[model samples]
Target: MFKHSKFAAVAILAISAYHGAAFAQDAADPVVAKVGGVEVHQSELTLAMTGLDPQLANLPEEQKRVAALSAIIDVKLLAADANKEGLQNDETFKQRVAYLTDRELHNAYFKKHVVDSVTPEEVKARYEKEIAAIEPQEEVHARHILVKTQQEAKDVIVALDGGKDFVELAKEKSTDPNKSEGGDLGYFTKGRMVPEFETAAFALEKGTYSKEPVQTQFGFHVIKVEDKRKQAPPTLEQVQDQVRQLVMRDKYVKLLEDAKAESTVEIEDPALKKAYEEVNKQQADQKPQQQ
Candidate 1:
C-alpha cells in the first residue's frame, strides 16, 4: 500500500507539471516533460524548490529533487488553470508579479555585489579594527535582594550587616524572579541596570552589600557586588559569522549610497518629495550628534 501511495504521489506531480506547460508552444523547448501532450521544464522545478522551507533543504538529494519536482508540477497545474480563466490579466495579478520581480532582482543584486564579495580576510580586519577602537570598560558580577517596599529592603540590608548570608536571605525574602538562583545576576556592564541600582551596585566594594535600601522604579533592592573586572572583547572564532555579516552590511550600504549618488533621482509626488527631504535632513542632523 505504501509503495502504491508513493508512486501515485510521483505520478500526480508529473501530471501537474505537464499540464502547467500546456499553454507553452511544443516547439519552444525539448527540455519540457510532456504529460497528455503538455510540457514541463527543469527550470520550473528548480524555481519551485528555491522557495521551499529551510528544513526541506536539509533532505537527502534524492528526496529534495522529488519534492521539488512535485512542487513544480503543482505550481504548473495552478498556473495553467489561472491562464485558462484569463486571471493573468487581472490588475491585482499584474501588481503582485511586478512586486515579486523587483524584490527578486534586488535580492539577486545584493547577493552578487555584497554577500558574495565579502571575504574572510575582510571580516577579520573589521573585527580587529573594532577591537582596537574599544576602550576597556568595567563589568561587575552582583546579586540583589528585591522587595516590594523600602522597609522590606532595609530589613534585608540590616540582616546582611548582622552577618546573614545574602543568598540565603534573598532566597527566603526576595520577590524578584532571580531569588531562586540566590539572586545571582551574573556579570554585566555599566548602564545595563537602572540608574539608581547601577549607582549603588557600582559603588560597593567586592564582598560588601549596600548599607542602605536602594530605591528604583522596580522597587527597593539590597545589592551585593561580588566582583569587578575589565570587560573582555569577543574572540574572532566566537563572532566570526557576526563579523562577516557586519562587513557585508557595510558593503551593501556603500553600494546603495554610491548608486544613489551616481543616479539621476527625482520624486514627482509632492508628499513623497517632502518626506524624502525630511528623511535626508534627519540623517544629516544625526552625523553631527555622532561626532
Candidate 2:
C-alpha cells in the first residue's frame, strides 16, 4: 500500500542498490514537472516506478507513471510547506538525510564496480570451467508400459514380441500419466527410477523390450530401451544466468576480502563479533553448486 513518495528525496532505492538512480542523475535528465523551481527528472520517475508501492508492478505502464507523478507532486508540495515550517534544520532529520545520502553513494559505487564490471566472456569462461569439472555420467533413454498386474505386464511383452508398436500399446494400456506420450520417460541417469525398474531398463539392449515384467513398489512395468549414452552437460544457454551470479558473487567476496585486510573492522560486542566471524568463515568455506 505504500507509494512512490517513499523514493522522492526520501528512502534510497534498496533494490540492487537502486541501480536506475545512476541513470536518473545523468545530465539532461528530462524535467517532467516542477515545484518551487525544483524539477522532477525522468530518472526519478523511473525509480518511483519500481521503488514505489511494489503492488504497482502489475499495473499498466501509463498508470504506473501517473501514480509516480502524483506521489512526486504530493511530496514536493508537503516538502515546500515543511521548509516554511523550518523542519529541514531539525537535527534528527539532517542525520537521517546524511545517512540516506551515504547509502545512495554506496549503492552507486556497487553498481559501477561490481554489477557492471562483469563481462559476457567472464561468464562463459566460468561456465566452461564448471562444466569441465563435472565427471561424465551414463544415462539411458527408455520407455515403459505400466499396468496394475503381472499378467498385464506379460501381455505387454507378448504384444511387443508379436510386433505390436510399443508406443501405441503403451498409449492404449499404460496407467501412467505419460501414457499419452507413449510412455516415454526421456533420458535419465541412474537413481532416477526405482531399483527394479532401473535394473530392468538399463539391462535391456538398445531397441529392445524387457522379456519379463519388472516389479516395483509402483506396480508392474514392461520397459523398453531406446538408446544409451553419456549424459550431456547442461548447455551454457540453460545455465548462463546462474553462472553470471556465480561470477558476481565470487567478485564481491574477493572485494570484501581485500577491503577487510586493509581496514580494521571493530566489533564492540563480543558475542556479535564471534557470530560475525563464524558467518564469514562459513561463507569462505562454502562452495557454490556450480562446482
Candidate 3:
C-alpha cells in the first residue's frame, strides 16, 4: 500500500514555528519567530498542522496545539541548519524535491477526479444492474451412505429395503465422516460436488434413494434425494458495500481510460513503455481475481 510521509515533515515544520524566540517572546497576531534574523510566522504553523497525522486530530485542543507548535520549531531548526550547510544547492536535493512535488500533484489529481467524484447513486445503480442479470440456479438437498465397495453399498440398500433405519445402517456400516450425522449432506448446488455423485443425487425424486450404487473417487454411495429448490440470489443489502466498491473501481478505470485516450501520451523510452504496459495488464488481470 502507498503511504504519505508529508505528515511527518509537516509536524516538524509546525514545531519550529512555535519554539523560536521570536514567537515565544512576542505577543501579537502572526507572531514572527526568528533564528539569527530568519523570520517564521504563526501562519506557517497552521499550514503545517493541515498535514498532521490524522490519528492526532482527535487529541484535546491544547495538546494538539502544543504538539503542532513543537513540530514546527524542530522543522525550522533542522531546515535552518541544512541551509547553513549549503545542501539546498546540491543537484540531488533539487531532483528529489522535484520528484516529490510531481508525485504530490498526481495524488491530488486522483483524489479530485476519481475518489471524490464517486457517488452513492452510481454505486446503487450498478448493484441493481448486476442483480437484474443474475440467473436462478438449482440446488439439491441430499444424504448418502458411503462404503468401500459397490457390494457394500448394495448390502446397505438391502438393509434399508428390509426396514432397517438408514441412519442406523449408516452408523453401523458407512465409513464417511457424515455417518455420525446420519450421512446428511445438507444442501448444495450443482458443480459443488463430484460429477458422479451429483449426477445420481439430482437424478432421484424427493424421498427416493439410489437403487444402483453410484461410483466416485471418494468411494461408492447410496444417495437419497431429500429436496430440491431454486437457489436464492443474495439481497442487495447483504452485499451493498461490495457493490459500492465495484462501482467506484469501474468508474475510476473508465475515467483513467478516457483521460489517456484524450491526451497525447508519449513514452520516450522503449523499456519504460513496455514496463508500463505490463503493469497495466497485470492490474487488469488482478481485478477479476479480487472479485
Candidate 4:
C-alpha cells in the first residue's frame, strides 16, 4: 500500500477538512492558526480533518478540527526547521516531495471522478436493476432425524408412519446436534445442505415426512418438510451501500476506458510488456460476456 511521511500525511489531513466550496479561497479563507509565523488557513484545517486519525474520527466534529490543527502546526514547525537547514534542497527530500505531490493529485482526481460523482439517484437506479435481475429461489424449513445406521433411520420412518410424533421420535433417536430441538434445520435454499439430504428434503411436500432413509456422508436422515416458500429479495435499505459501490465502480471503469482510448501507453520492459498486453487482452475478451 502507499503511505505518506508524517509531514505529508498531516498536510493532506488538514486540507481534507475544508468544505468543497472553500477551494474558492476568497476573503472567506480565515487564518485558523499561526505556526512559526506562517499562517494556517481554514481550508487547510478543514482538509486535514477529512483524514483524521481513526481515534480522532470518533471525536466530536469540533474536537476533530482542533486535533487536525494541532497536527498541522507540528508539521509546519518541523518544516520550518528543515527549510532553515536546507533539507528541502536535498535530492532524496525533493524526490519524496515530488511523489507526495503526484499522489495527492491522483487522490483529488479520484475523489472528483469516482467518489463524489456517484449520486444517490444513480445508486437507487442500480439497486433497482440488481433487484430486477434476481432469480426467485425456493427455501425449505425442515427437521430431520440423523442416525448412524440405515436401519435406525428406517425405524424412525416407521415410527412416523405409525402415527408417532416426529419431533418426539427425533428427540429420542437422532444423533445430530439439533436432536434436542428435534433436529430442526431452520430454513435453507437448495445447495445449502449435502446433496442426498437436500434432494430428499426438497422432494417432500410440506408437512410430509420421508418414507425412507436419505443416505449422505454424515449418516442416514429421515427428513420432514415443515414449510416452503420463495426467498424474498433484500430491501434497498438493506443493500444501499453495496449498490452505491457498484454504481461507483461502473462509473470509474467507464472513465478509465475513455481515458485509455485517448492516451498512448507503452511498456518498454519485455516481461512487463507481454504481461500488460495479456492483461488487456483478457479484459477485452470479457467485454462480450459483460455486455
Which candidate has the top score in lDDT? 2
lDDT of 2 by residue, 143-199 (tens): 999999999999988889999999999999999999999999999999998899998
Error of 2 at 180 (Å): 4.6
- Tens-place lDDT per residue, model 1, 116-183, is 99988898898898788889899999999999998898888778888899999989999999899999
Off by over 4 Å in 4: 1-33, 41-46, 49-70, 90-92, 286-291
Score every model by TM-score: 0.60, 0.80, 0.62, 0.73
Could you tell me which residue pairs clash in candidate 1? none
Off by over 4 Å in 2: 1-27, 162-164, 287-291
Q: What lDDT is reached at residue 80 by model 3?
A: 85
Sequence-dependent TM-score of model 4: 0.73
Task: Please state every model's RMSD to the true fold in angstroms.
Answer: 11.7, 12.3, 12.8, 12.1
lDDT of 4 at 256: 78
- Model 3: lDDT equals 0.83
TM-score of 3: 0.62
Candidate 1 at 224: error in angstroms?
2.0
List residue ranges in candidate 3 displaced over 4 A: 1-84, 270-291
The Cα RMSD in angstroms, rounded to one decimal, for candidate 2 relative to the true structure is: 12.3
